[model samples]
Target: MIQTGQSIPEVVVQQITPKGIEKTDTVSLFGTGKTVLFAVPGAFTPTCSEQHLPGFVQHFDEFRRQGYDVACMAVNDPFVMQAWMKSAGVPDGMRMVADGNAELARALGLELDASAYGMGIRSKRFAMLIQDGAVKQLFVEAPGEFRVSTAEHMLEAIAG
Candidate 1:
């Protein structure tokens, strides 16, 4: 798994744009600023929809005030992610990123095999603070758990 001070992999991540789905390198998204990034197992899942994502959206302005750009990533396509954002009423402060094919998830060593559950490979729940292209802090949840990798937890870590 990627650790503190390690550079994130330069993989392609897609997001919805006015014209259509636009693709960009992962580094470009989390590489340059004090970035707050959280990953969920999948979009629209029970915990993710009801809790994980909402927490971030609620704290989005606070994260920005703390000098961070917040984003949520999933192992879903950009279209699905966009739809999820609308469905969940996610605010503009939080951007949705698609790691389709698990590219970034695999590079971070956070891929969870869920074939038995018919979900294939998905990202493990995680939140991290990235600064100037390097990881400053990372909180990866235990299997099927969601205790640490939360917006509040990340904010607390950042405050300290």
Candidate 2:
């Protein structure tokens, strides 16, 4: 797993934009400023659609007010991510990352072997605070648990 003080790996990723799918790199995405990057196993999964993503959407302003850029990453493709963003009514403050091949997850050492679940390789539920290319804090949830990585928890953690 990526430890605090370590720089985020430079891996190319994709995101769905108004124009089309845009290719971007992790360094440019999370390296330049304070970023709250949250990951889910897959897009449209129950917990992810109901709680995980919504929590971030609800507290997005709080994060932004504190000058943190919020982003969501999933192992799904850009098309799925874009659909989820629209369906969830995600605000403009949040950026969606499509880790289709789990490249970023593997780089962070946060990949989950979910083949048994028929999901193939996916990202574990986690959140990280990255500042100026280095990780400041990391909250990785235990398997089948939702606690530390929630937006509310992250807000409290950051405040402290």
Candidate 3:
């Protein structure tokens, strides 16, 4: 997996925005400043919709106030990702990445084989603290667990 101090991989991904779906690369999306990019196994899944993504939504302002751009990525289509964020009431400017082909996950070596569950290839649940395109800190959750990658945990991580 990509480690701390490693730069974010250069891969083109799609982002959902008010204007329309836009193509963006990791460097352009996360290269400018501090960013907290959290990945979900899939959009609208139980834990993701109920807890993981909500934690970040609830603390969106806090992350921004601390000089960090917040982004959520999922191995779902741009349309579904946009719908999920809308259903979750995400604020404007919060980025929603659509890793439709699992390109980013595979590149980061964080792909999860969930074929048994019929979910196909998906991203492992994790969060990364990035600065100027390099990973500064990373929190990856164990399979079926939801502790380390939450927004509350990330807040504490940056605070200290």
Candidate 4:
């Protein structure tokens, strides 16, 4: 997994919008500003939709208040991401990114295989605090665990 002070991999992501899908590079998505890049195992999955993503959604205002642009990435297709965000009631501040091929996950060294659970190659559940396009802090969950690395924790990290 990526660590603090390391430069994250520059990868392309597809953004699903009401009109259509748009391709965007990581540098463009992250830009030269503070960002919170959170990755989930899958879109619309039990924990991801109910807990992980919603945690960020619920605290999105606080994140922005602390001066961070937020983005969520998953290994699903752009269409799936779009529907998931709508169904999950994602807030306005969070941008959903589709990494359909796992390229970004592999580049970040956070890819996880969940074939036993019927999920293909996917990103591990994690979140990072990035500043000026460089990683400043990383919060990665143990497999099948959800607690730390949540939006609340990241909010505290931002505060401290």
Candidate 2: Cα lDDT at 49:
98
Which residues of candidate 4, in runs, are more than 4 Å off?
none
Candidates sorted by lDDT, best first: 3, 2, 1, 4
TM-score of each: 0.96, 0.98, 0.99, 0.95
* Quality of model 2 by C-alpha lDDT: 0.94
Among all windows of 10 consecutive residues in model 1, the one with the lowest summed lDDT is: 15-24
Model 3, range 1-160, lDDT digits (tens) per residue? Answer: 9999999999999999988799989999998799999999999999999999999999999999999999999999999998998999998889999999999999999999999999999999999999999999999999989999999999999997
Candidate 4 residue lDDT tens string, 119-158: 9899999999988778999988998798777889899888
lDDT of 2 at 96: 95
Candidates' C-alpha lDDT:
0.89, 0.94, 0.96, 0.88
Q: Best TM-score goes to which candidate?
A: 3
Superior by TM-score: candidate 1 or candidate 3: 3
The TM-score measured for candidate 1 stands at 0.96
lDDT of 2 by residue, 1-160 (tens): 8899999999999977777689999888977889999999999999999999999999999999999999999999999999999999899858999999999999999999999999999999999899999999999999999999999999987898
Off by over 4 Å in 3: none
